[model samples]
Target: MKTFPTIETERLILRQLRPEDSVDLYNYFSKDEVTEFYDLDSFTELQQAESLIRIFNDRFITQQGIRWGITLKTEDKVIGTCGFHNWSKKHFKAEIGYELSPEYWGIGVMTEVLREVINFGYKELELNRIEAFTYPDNIKSRKLLEKSGLSEEGYLKKYYYVKQRFVDAVIFSIIKEEVTNDERSKN
Candidate 1:
């Protein structure tokens, strides 16, 4: 199994999910506004979040992909989760996905954490490519990807079935490059 050493950003800690963080995650996910653009169903109850966290813990040992809990250093709260998944083994490619609480939106937290995780995927995990898909309506995430130096590739109409409706997904990505290496070198 592959282990992720703890990763730190200026105001946050990117670490493996824990059972105790279920409530914080639930608090974030339970909001209609937060989950409105995200793919997951809204967390109705706190216990469901705990159950999901337990499953996330098991997933770490399995090591097929990684889902990290984004925790704030200031408040000791889990603000969101992001991960690599939907892999193509032969191609050495995988899609990255992320969601954050409404409270943390527009603060640049996800941008910092994503740059760290993407570099980890390249340098430590030996991936050649990492990409992300977002609904066309998700301008916030698209901006984050752009700020991290990814470019829009194309649009896939009805690219995903989310929230019981067909939605357009805009694909954005970064190839291994000097720019990507530049992001990797930052502490």
Candidate 2:
């Protein structure tokens, strides 16, 4: 955990977020469609992306979390990000979150990324559990979590107050043992 890990998949490279990625991050985050399910409003300025990059990197440095900037292997520009947040080493658990450019939606990009990230969480981080929460209306996210092998646990009412109002969330979780059993079955 001393150095940030870089994960690569067949068509993508998940790398550390750098200051140079602000423009790419801003391009998508500036769109209302991209932030519709996110807690933050559509970004209005470049500095907001810069601050977010700093915050994401800070989390890794503090051992609180890790977020990877997603890019295609042929290009360095970030199209989106995914990572673990609310990590608790003592509890051996963390929350997973991700967002991709709408352009990449329904194309299996996030699915591939989630597969690798989830494996890393269980193998490298030694996490016993990884969970995710999504706004109840986010059908795509809910489907993605299930496709990635997480089971829906239940609904949590008024879990977060975002955009000035309380909102409910649906939770999903996957355990290390479940993943192990899955890989065994696949083999």
Among all candidates shown, the one with the greatest lDDT: 2
75, model 1: CA deviation in Å?
A: 3.5
lDDT of 2: 0.97
User: What lDDT score goes with residue 156 in model 2?
Assistant: 100
TM-scores of all predicted structures = 0.88, 0.99
The TM-score that candidate 1 achieves is 0.88
Q: Report model 2's TM-score to 2 decimal places.
A: 0.99
Candidate 2 per-residue lDDT, tens place, 1-187, comes to 8999999999999999999999999999999999999988999999999999999999999999999999999988899999999999999999999999889899999999999999999989999999999998999999999999999999999999999999999999999999999889999
Tens-place lDDT per residue, model 1, 1-187, is 4666678888888888878898888988888877777777888889989987776666566666678899888777789988787656577777888888887888888888898888887876677888998878878888898998788999999878878898898999887674566758994
lDDT of each: 0.81, 0.97
Off by over 4 Å in 2: none
The clash count for each model shown is 0, 0
Q: Report the C-alpha displacement of residue 177, candidate 1, in angstroms.
A: 2.5
